[model samples]
Target: MTLNVLFAARPERWESYEPILKSEFARQGLDVALSTDHPPETVDYIIYAPNGPVQDFTAYTRCKAVMNLWAGVEQIVGNETLTQPLTRMVEEGLTGGMAEWVTGHTLRYHLEMDLDLARKPGDWSQHNPPLARDRPVTILGLGQLGQAAGQMLAGIGFPVTGWSRTQKDIEGITCLSGDEGLIEALKTAQVLVLLLPDTPATTNIINPESLALLPKGAVILNPGRGPLIDDDALLAALDLGQVAHATLDVFRTEPLPEDHPYWHHPKVTVTPHIAAETRPATAARVVAENIRRGEAGEPFLYLVDRDQGY
Candidate 1:
């Protein structure tokens, strides 16, 4: 079938995906027209990026869906002009990168590797760390990224507990959900990883009250949405030893203003939003597959439900 796909992402990204996309389409035996600018009202699917120039989707009357290249869709979801189905990027590249980064840091802290490596030769102090089974990890969100990281930790014998708004069943992980289950999950968590989406309900999810529920020397790792954690409360928790340290990969602001306390904090590790990245080569194929399904009268994969707000 012929499809009028609009590639609304930036000019820079075009070169990366153009060849790969064309090859994928040809393999699927589909006739496709790619356009940098939104076409006349007949646009069937829009390949989107929130930072791109396409804001008004109302004109694209025939558009079946807005397939986002980036996983975080909070930027474009709130637009009133958008009436089309929105699907966030779900690809192996992103999932693998997130799992690797989270697991790397979790193991680093758990093993006390940094302290042992930096110590002077004469002072071989045997400051042993607790066993993996004794250390509990509380993962917020329990979504794709969270679940993947939890499984990696669980494989190494760490007692992993996951907290989400809804209950989930996964092998080797203690999954907790809803308001009541939060406290139970937090109490046993020595390491907390934030992976929740940034909706109104999730804002400041790691406030002082929630932070207090965790073990006193808990380490906080945020590779998820920036606003899910309250900046001030995290620092306060660190001040009182409620939270021993925080490894932050996201922030409320991009470029993370020069004056931010997290930048200077001794107990904080600030990564420039590099926890996970969408690889255009792989992500474009996922986008194309969904579009193919829509064209072939098959159910779309990863279709966003606007009412649930993801």
Candidate 2:
């Protein structure tokens, strides 16, 4: 029997993803009829995006699973109508992109490159940077992206510590978990990276109390969710010189609001949320593989825990 797969995302995304998904389905040896328009009741699976047209999932009674196009699922997890098993996108492209971005920014901070780049003419003051081995980098979150970033940093000799809500034991990383572990992780972070998901428990996790844990003049890099850090607390920290600089990619409001304080703050570097994006080729394989898993009765990969809200 041919499985009906609905591509429920933006029109532009349909054009980009249709052929890749079709090719991937063929490569996986699955008889999938992929389309942008399929009767909700007939859809065996939904390739979903939060901004997509399919909001109410009550009609999609046959949908065995929802394969998300993006890595984050905060927007879709709360939909009361969505009862199907949902899987977040986890592919080589997304992971690689995130790792590379994190590495680039981490290196920038470690090397103190910005000072040289922005130096005034004839102001040649010599400033030498310590090697990566001397830098203690802490990452909040030990998921695929975080782990990959940690591994990359570790490879370059940075002493990397990773903290998650749950314990993880990845090689080359000092993995910490629980409340005590968070405090310890913050204490050691000369440079800190945020990669945790957006959940109630995680929102504003990097507030005043957490900021006070870091050593004076610590650098912060946030490519995770915007709400993870309390903006007010971070601003206060910056004013107090507790945190020397912050490079923020994701934000509570996208385009970061023209009048946002982060934009005017001299200590903050805001990059339009370009840290990572789902690559069509690799993401298609992930979607197709999950569909194949659903068909074969195997457990899905990257399935979201509804209660945890990731």
Q: Per-prediction count of colliding residue pairs?
A: 0, 0
TM-score of 1: 0.96
In order, what lDDT does every prediction score?
Answer: 0.88, 0.95
Residues 1-310 of candidate 1: C-alpha lDDT, one tens digit per residue: 5688889888898999888888888777779987786464978888899988799887899999899888788888788999988998889899889988989999889998879778997986887888899889989978788889999999998999999898999888999998889999989989999998888889998998999998999999999989988899999999899998899999999989999999999999999999999997788789879878988889888877676566
**Stretches of candidate 2 above 4 Å error?**
none
Candidate 2 lDDT over residue span 21-81, tens digit each: 9999999999988988998889999999999898999999888999898999999999999
Q: Which ten residues in a row have the lowest lDDT in candidate 2?
A: 287-296
